[model samples]
Each structure stands twice: as C-alpha cells, then as structure tokens.
Target: MVIYIILFGYLGLSLLLSRLNIRSKIEDSAQYYLTNRSLKGITLFFTLVATNFSAFFFIGFAGESYRVGYIYYTMMAFGTSFAAISFYLIGSPAWRLSKDKGYITPAEMLGDQMNSTALTRLTALLMIIFMVPFVAIQIIGAGLIVSGLTQGAIPYIWGSALLMVFILVYIWRSGMYSVARLDVTNGILLMTLIILAFVFVSRSLGGISEINEQLMEQSAALFSPQGSNSTYSPSLWLSYMVLWLTCLPMFPQIFLRFLMAKKESNFRYTSFLYTIVPPLLFIFPVALGVMGHLSFPDLQGKAADQIIPRLLTMHLPGGFGAVILTGALAAFVSTTDSTLLALSSLIARDLYKPIFKPQLDEKGTLTVGRISILILCLISLVIAFFQPASIFQIAAMTFSGLSIFFPVFLAVLRFNYRKPISAILAMILGEVVLILFATIFSGACDTLNILPVVPGVLATILILWLGHFFEKNKD
Candidate 1:
C-alpha cells in the first residue's frame, strides 16, 4: 500500500506539473516543440541532466558495476564527463544555424545544410530506428526495477507499460515544454536520492572502509583497472570511451537540447554541470553496485540490474527505500518522456510533414506527433517484453547504434560537407556494418577485442571524408 501510494502520488505530481506548464492552446511548432527557445541556466541544466541520466544510469550502471567491478565507473563517469564538452563544440553552431533558419528537428538542419530532401528523410528514419531501442532500454530498466521491487506481483510487462503510458500523458499534453519542466523536478529528486542512497548504503554496509576491506578480502580484482574478468581490454576501453563521447551528444534527445537552448552560455553552463555533477553522483550507484558484491555475490546477468532495488528494499530502512525507489521511477519517467517527444517531433516534422503530408499545418502536425507517441509507447513496450539482454548490454548497443551517425552530424555541422549521398551512405552503411558485425561477424568482433561501433563510426567518417575529397577535386 505504501509503495502504491508513493508511485501514484509521484505520477500525479508529474501530471499536475505538466498541466501547470502547458499552454492551454499550443499554436505553433515553436511553442509546442522547443518551448519558445526559453530554456536557459537552471531549467535547461536540469532537463539536460535528467534526460541524459535515466534508469539506464541508475540501474544499468550499477548492474554493470556489479558484473565487471570499478572499471565501469572510469568508463561511464569520467568518460561521460569528458563527452559533455561537445555541448559547446557542436551545439553553438547548430543553435546559430537553427536561429537563422528556424530549424526544429535534426534532419531539418542537416537537410537544409546539405540541400537534400533525401538526406532529411533518411536521417529521420535512421534516428527513429536507432532511438526506439534506446526508448526500449528505458522501459526495460523500469520493468526490472518495478517487478524486482514487487517480487513478481506486478509482472515486468505491466510494470513497464504502467510508467510508459503515464509518461506519455504529460508529454502529449504540452510536448517538450512539459517534458522540460518535469525534468527539473525529477533531476533534483534523482540527484538527492542518489546521494542519500550512496551515503545510506555505505553506512548500512558498515562504511566505505569496511566495504573496501570486504571487497579486498573477497574479490580485490574488482579494484583493478581491468576489472574482475578483464572485461575492459585496452581496445574495449578505447571503444567505450569513443562510444560515450561520440555517441552521447548525438542522442536525438540530447541533440534536441541544443536546439532548445536560449544562448551559448546556456550550453556552457549545462555542459559544465554535466561534466562535474553526473560523475560525482554516479559514484553513489557505481559504489553501491561494487559493495553489492559483498552481500549479493550470487546475483548475475540481468538479475544484477536489481542491485539498487534489492539493496534498498532488503537491506535499508523502509521509508528511505521508498524515497529512493521514487527516485528510480523519476529517472524512468524523465528520460522516456524526453525520448518519446524527440522521436515524435522528428517523425512529425521530418517524415510526416514533408514526405507523407506536405500540407500538415501546426494542428495537424501536433495530432500526428501525439499519435506517434502512442505508437512508440506500444512498440517500446513490446520490445521490453522480450527481455533480449541485460539493461547494460542493450544500452551499450543503442549507444553504439547512435554513435555511428555522430560523424555524419559532425561532417555536415562542423565541416561544411555538402554531399548528401555521403551523409546518407554513412547512415545506411554504418548501420549495416554495425548489424553485420553484431550478427554474422559476432565472433570476429570478439576475436578483434574492439566493439562493432568502432568500425561502424570509422566507416561513417571514412565515407564522409572520401566524399569531401572527391567533391573538392570535382569543384
């Protein structure tokens, strides 16, 4: 009863907050999608952090840490901090271009810059394809957290769909406006709970020193740079570093943040916060996952994703655990809402408006976008049902999937590359290479010790460069 009350209460607060923020009548794409470009300073900072760190951050990071050990921290925390600087590098120019051109979606910006309608459509399609898996990762995380906490009372599908549908209600009402506003509240709650859980979990386990001593006696290889199983090889380490840095900012939701910024300084402030704050907060979950080895050493694979919930429910006090559980729910809600909005906006603007219904007015686009949200929710829920892999593995796969397109974005945005074929080929072939390696060439990837995304991203860059070279010669 306590858990149900807290869950419904949190969802109710989110719905109320969205109602308060949403315009009674959304009249234009500008108002509905980008929030009139008003996001700056603290609101923008919170939304960016909230969207970037999801159930994936809390559950996946902890689960990966439990599986491999401390190396997950260096890969995720420090590496992601380094990636945050791209906000200024990539965002500033995109903001300037969008400001001048009234660009709303990423495909719109790329298409205008490349002068290719084909590129615009393909970009939208590819991003949607790659992003659905990411959205599913959020659902998967939510399912694991909820079903684990309830011990099968709710079941994973119901647990996943419950939050997925609840999130859609707010986002469909006000679009990014509501999503961004909700992000502020969830971001604060998530950080506070993470810090509290870290401090409380360490204390409950008898302190950081005691936890460290136990690990030293039980499995000290966990402290090594290579981790317990040497899972993070030098090549693999390099792969993840590239994956987080290159692929992270290119996430359509994060990319949308660049479009939503009010000024260059907003990017700077948010970037700095991302660099410093997330890495620190991550210490909480990663450390919790590490210490979990002492008590829950038998937990393995996808079961490990339950470490945070397990620790809180069984080992910690009930009230504090409920508070922390709310934080987990907040993480799922915040991220899935943003992801759905981004995917819907891209489909509405880039795909539906241009290709299928060139006559789409703001009202019509709004309807299509709302409909897309429902469809995506259903699709993500279906994917969540399969439980194909661990949350960490699925998250990594999606990260790499998106990373394959990062170079194309850089080529168009940063390098003034004008060949649409190059961008299109990069998108198609990068994904093709990624698929081949992950599927038929799976064993080869293992033998190579480098992940498929490395070659995939490299393929994208190579094609873009060659296109630039040939075009330069032709000109």
Candidate 2:
C-alpha cells in the first residue's frame, strides 16, 4: 500500500511540474521543441544525463553485465566517457550553428547546411525508424520492472501501456520544457537510488569481497576481461566500444539536446560533468549485476533483466523498494518522453508540415507535433506489448542503425561535402550495410564474427568517398 502511494505520488508530482510549464505561452516551434534555447547550467546538465541514462543503462546494461561479465562495464565506461569529447567536437559547433541560424532539429541543420529538402526528410525518416525501437526498449524495460516488483500483480502489457500513457500525457502537454524539467528530477533520483541500491545490496551479500569470492568460485570467467562466459570476443568488444562512442552523440534525442543549450559556455560545463558522472553512475548497476550473478546464477533469458528489481523486492523493505522502483521508473520516463518529443518534432517539422501543409503556422505546427506524440506513443506501445527481444539486443540494433548517420554528421560539421546526392547515397549505403550485417546475414556467418556497426560505418565512409569522386569527375 505504501509502495503504491509512493508511486502515485511520484507520478502526480511529475505531472504537476510538467503542467506548470504548459501555462507559458509557446510563441513558436522553437519554444516547443528547443525550449526557446534557454536551458543552462544544472538544468541542462541533468537533462542531458537523464536523457542519456535510460532503461538501456538500468535494465539492459545491468542485464548484459550479468550475462557476460565485467567486460560489459569496461566497454560501457570507456564508450560513454569518450562520448563526452563529442560535446566539444560535435556539440559546440552544432550549438554555435544552431544559435546563429535558429536550427530546431538535427535534420533541419543538415538540410540548411546541405541545402536539400530530400536530405532533411531522409534524415528524419531514419531517425524515426531507429528511435521508435529505442523507445520500445524503454517501454519493455519499464514493464519488466513493474511486473517484477509487483510479483506479477500487474501484467507486462498493462504495465507498459500504463507507463506509456503517463509519459505521453505530460510530453504532449508542454514538449521539451516538460521533458527538461522532469529530467532534472529524474536525474537526481536516479543517482541517489543507484548508490543506495548498491550499498544495501552489497551489505546484504556480506560485502563486495564476499560477492567477488562467490563469483570467482561460481564462474571465474566473470573476472576475465572478455567475461567469465566468453560472450564478447576481442573484435566484438572493439566494435561495441566504437558503436557507442560514435552513436551516442549522433542519437536524435542527444543531438537535439545539444541544440537546446542557452549558450556555448553551457557545453563546457556539460562536458566536464558528463565526463565524470556517467562512469560513477554506471559502477553500481554493473556491481548489482555481479551481485545478481552470485545470488541467482541459474537464471536465463529475459530473466536476467529482472535481476535488479528482483533483488530490490527480496532484500529491501516495502518503502525502500518503492523508492528504488520509482527511480527506475524515472529513468524510463526521462528517456521515453525525450525520444517521443524528438520523434514528434521530426514528423511535424520535417515531414508533415513541409510535405503536407507548408502554410501551417506556429500553432498548427505545435498541434501537429502534439498529435504526432500520441500516434508515436501508440505505435511504440504496440511494439512493446509484443515484447520482441531483450532490451540490450533491441538497443544494440537501434544504435547500429543510428550510427549510420555519424559520417553524414561529420560531413556537415567538419568536412565540406555538401552535395545532396552524396549525403543521400551515403545514408542509403550505410542503411543497406547495416540491414545486411545486423539482420539478413548476422548469425549465418558466425566465423567472421563482426558487429554490424563495424561494416555500417565503413560502408558510410566508402559511399561518401565514392560520392566525392563522382562529384569531382562531373566537374
């Protein structure tokens, strides 16, 4: 009963905070999508953190660590830390360009830089394709947590639907302003719960040394760099590292956040905080997985993803369990709402208004964006209800697909490759390679054992070079 009250209270508080922003008149799509480019300091920092640390971190990362071992941590820590450098390299310049030209979405920036309507639509299409599955992953994670915590009192499908509805309501109300405000609350709760869960679980298990000793005895491979089970090879690990490092900055959700900064100086502070915080935040979840392995070594399949929630239910008292569960829910809502808002902005700004109703004013555009949010949420809910795959696998495929845009973004930011043909062909070639490697021929050719991002990235570069060659020859 107390847990239920806490959960309801948390939801009520979030909705009230989001509603407070709805009273602020939105003068244009800029205010709706970018929050009028007014985010700064702590608000900017926490939103970025909250947006990045999704269910993928809490559920997927922890589960993978449990399944494979410590190698997952090493790869994630390095990949996430390296991603911070993007704030300087990619984010700062993007911020300056957006501030100068009033860019709203990443596609808008690319379209302006390359002067191609087709390229803008294509960019938005790819983001929707990749981001929807990413959103579905969060929904799945939330469902698992709710079901697990309640001991199946709420079924997975209902849990997922409930969470999605909650997210859709607030996000549909105020757009990015609501997302940033909620993100600040979620970020603080996430950090606090993670530390508390780690300390309490560690104590219950007789400390870290005992946990390590048990793991070594149960499976010495857990301590090995590649994991106790050889789940990730040297090649696979390298590919994962590269995939995360490049893809994190390019993700539409994160990309839009870069443009939301109030000033260039915000990026400097964001960079410093981003570098130090994620690695620390990741430590406890990875440790929780290690602890879960000791406690429940025989669990298999999707069961591993439930390790954290299960541990909380068994060890913590009712009130503490509710707090941690709410924190995990915060992580889910933070990511889901941001992705939904980004998707809506993409559809409304890039595709719907441009292609269908060019004369739509700011009010009409905001209406389209809100309606798109509802539609996208329903689509994602359907996907989540089916529960196609584990959170990590779904997220990995999504990241690989999104990574295809890295080179195109590079061309926009660093290089002078401004041809529409080049950008379009590069994206197409990258997507083809990603589909072939990540889907069509993934498991059949196990002897090669390369991650999809490895070839997807290379294919993008090759196509860009080929495009450049053709352009030069034409001249």
Q: Model 1's lDDT to the true fold?
A: 0.82
User: Which 10-residue span in candidate 1 carries the lowest summed lDDT?
Assistant: 466-475
Looking at model 2, report the run of 10 residues with the lowest lDDT sum.
466-475
What TM-score does prediction 2 earn? 0.94
List, residue by residue over 56-170, the lDDT tens digit for candidate 2. Answer: 6776777878887877788888789887877776788889889999888898888878888999999999888778878877887788777766667878888898888888777
lDDT of each: 0.82, 0.83
- Candidate 1 runs further than 4 Å off: 386-396, 472-475
Compose the digit string of candidate 1's lDDT tens values, residues 246-323: 887778888888878888788777788778986678888899899988779899678888788888876786656877
Model 1: clashing residue pairs? none
For model 2, what is the error of residue 222's alpha carbon versus the real structure, in angstroms, after optimal superposition?
0.7
Clashing pairs in 2: 221-228, 222-228
